[model samples]
Target chain A: MFENLLTWLDSPQTLQAIVVTGSLLLFGIGFYGLLAYTRIIKILISLSIMESALFVFFLGLASDPHKTAPILGDLFKNFEKMNDPVPQAAILTAIVISLATMSLGISFAIEYYKRTGKNDIAQMDALGEKR
Target chain B: MTGFITLFTLLSMSVVALFSLRQSNLTQSVVLFSGVGLGSVVLFFIFNAPDVALTEAVIGSGITAVVLLIGIRHMHKEPEIEEVMMENRRGIRRIAIALLVLLTLLLLGKTLLGALSVETSNAGQALLEHAMQAGAANAVTSVVTYFRGFDTLGEVAVLFLAATGVGLLLTVEKGEDAIYIEPNFILRIGSGFLFPLILLFGLYIIVHGHLSPGGGFQGGVVIAAAFLLLFLTRRRFGLSHKIVTILESGAGMAYVLLGLTGLWLMGLFLGNFLPHPAEKIGMLVSGGIIPIIYILIGIKVGSEISYVVEKLIKRSHDV
Candidate 1:
């Protein structure tokens, strides 16, 4: 049993499995936050957490233990044994785009708070029937 | 050895994410959220994605946390007391919902891990094979600027729209009160000493993008960070909105014009038209149009984010 566990730990797939489980748990945490929190900032934070989980999952899965980074340098002469560059590039774009959206959401929340004097989403009843 | 490190980082990240969400204090939560970003940076490095790691360190960990804290500063502090009260009154239904979500996610993750093979796709392999033809040493940079250039253009457009939206939403009239905090003497002196170095480092990252790990987006965020430091440290300092707008617009137009030039010259949008001799690969000046495009992107992203930051802080309105 100990030998079996050792073999499992040595395999590259072990890292991938850990990443998958961890990111899923992180996503769940974000989901819980989104459902439990009423503040706009908290919701935004939850959304960003969800996004980060997805980014981690994507990059972690695409990575290979045997290969080096895709940059051809003095040490790495070519792309023969390099991790996939496409996902990294795509995730890079996604990170910037997510930052843009997060900031935009924050700006909207700030404006809403300034106008309504309320920061909680549950309290945003400006269009509802008067109490 | 790497496996153990990865396991530890992931575990810590999970803990940090949980704590950040559970924390009642808004400021503490924001700081803990940045800790999560820090953990991801380490994970990205371990995963052999140095480019993505750099970008995350700059934009995800650094700028996003700053933006969140500034956003918190913009709001009145009294609402948080009500938030704390709401936290206490959370019903059992919320816990039940959270448990349900957790169970569903676990099931989904299990199925996903089983179905997805641990290998690169055929498309990715093909990109890797031809990535060198773009004349950049960093395959990710080549893929981002040369192969998937159109998507990046659209991304820049999205950032522009977001920045414009923030500006519109947060535009303070002349009579409106602006946020002003007394500058710390230490921070003021330190930022003055650090500003030029940060700008220089941002330029190095942007310029060396084709030969190294960083590129326009990461370098751009670093540049904006320098401006952020100025905003935080210096009391009456504000960016000239007109100048920033001009710089952003000009850089964006130049990017498109470069693409048009590629199309006109080689019949492919963003095609590498300049001479990029294969022997010269890995050299700083070897990537021809790739480095130029990255430089333009760096400028555009830097100016756009700076503009957004200025709008968020309401400092430019006075200027």
Candidate 2:
């Protein structure tokens, strides 16, 4: 039984499984926060968390146990067993874009507060809705 | 083994994320969120994606956390409406949400397990084989700056839009003075000492992008971070709007002109128009137009983010 456990732990699939489970749980936590939080800032934070979870999931799944980084050098020549570069590039773009969006959302929230003096989403009834 | 370490990091990251969301203080929550970013950097490194790791470390943990904290600082403290909502929520509704989330996660897990059995596509391998054609040692850099260069331009445009929106929304009115807190001697002296070194390091990262694990985005954020530090120390210091605007717009226009040059020389936009011999793969002056494009991106991103940071912290007077 101990040897079986050891073998399972050694496998690349085991690491990938752990990564997926962790990131999904992280996403669920963010989802719960989005539903539960009333503050616009908290909701934005949760949304950013969700985005990070997806980034982690993509990069984690694209990786392999045997491969090194996808950079050629004297010690490690060629891309024979390198981790996928596509996902890394994609995730790099996503990270920057997400930062931009998060900051934009936060600026909107700040403006909303400055103009209306209300920070809670429950209180934002600017468009003819009775609060 | 590496797998075990990665597993531990993943577990710790999830725990941090949960705790960050559960924190009552917004500042504390932002700090905890940065902790989550730190974990991700570790995971990225372990997974052999050092470029992503560096980007996450600089942008995710450093800049994003600072931006969130400044955002909280900009707003006045309010009563805990969330607590009231928690108390007023019906037990049945709460239970329903809890169960639904669990069920959805279970379904996702099952799908993921099934999908794991299928073979990953060979697209990445094909790209890897062509990565040398771009004359970059780092495959990720070549893929980002050469293979999918147009997508990166779009991403930069999105960042520009965000910066513009932030500037439009957060413009401080005339005659309104910024609230400045005096920094202590240690912070003032230390930040002054570290600023030049940090800027130099960011330049190094940008210049060596094609041969190393970092590129424009990561280095750009690092440069912005140095400015953030300077902002923290000084009271009345302000980045000249004209200079920053010129730097950002000029870099952007230069990027497009370079792309047009490629389109004119080669049939494809943003193509490697210059000669990039395979023998020059690991050299600094290699990668044809890629290094030059990255430098432009670095300058643009650095200037833009620093401008955003300045606007956020100072609520600057100049519109």
Compare the candidates by DockQ and give the number of the best one: 2
lDDT of 1 by residue, B1-319 (tens): 6667777887898899889988888889999999989999999998999999999999889899988988888775556356543554477437756676677566557644665446643458888888767788999999999999999999999999999898878777752545666777887788899999999999999999999999899999999999988876776778887898788999999999999999999999998899988779988889779999999999999999988887887623446
What TM-score does the A-chain of candidate 1 achieve? 0.90
Q: State the lDDT at B23 in candidate 1.
A: 84
Model 2, span B182-229: residue lDDT tens: 888988899889999999999999999999999899889899999888
What are the runs in model 1 whose C-alpha is more than 4 Å off? A1-7, A129-131, B84-121, B175-177, B315-318
Q: Candidate 2 chain A: worst 10 consecutive residues by lDDT?
A: A6-15
Cα deviation at B309, candidate 2, in Å, is 0.7
In model 2, the runs with Cα more than 4 Å from the true position are: A1-4, B80-82, B86-97, B104-116, B174-179
Please provide TM-scores, in order, for all candidate models, with all chains considered together: 0.93, 0.94
Kindly report, for each predicted structure in the order presented, the TM-score of its chain A compared with the true chain A: 0.90, 0.91
Candidate 2: give the clashing pairs.
none
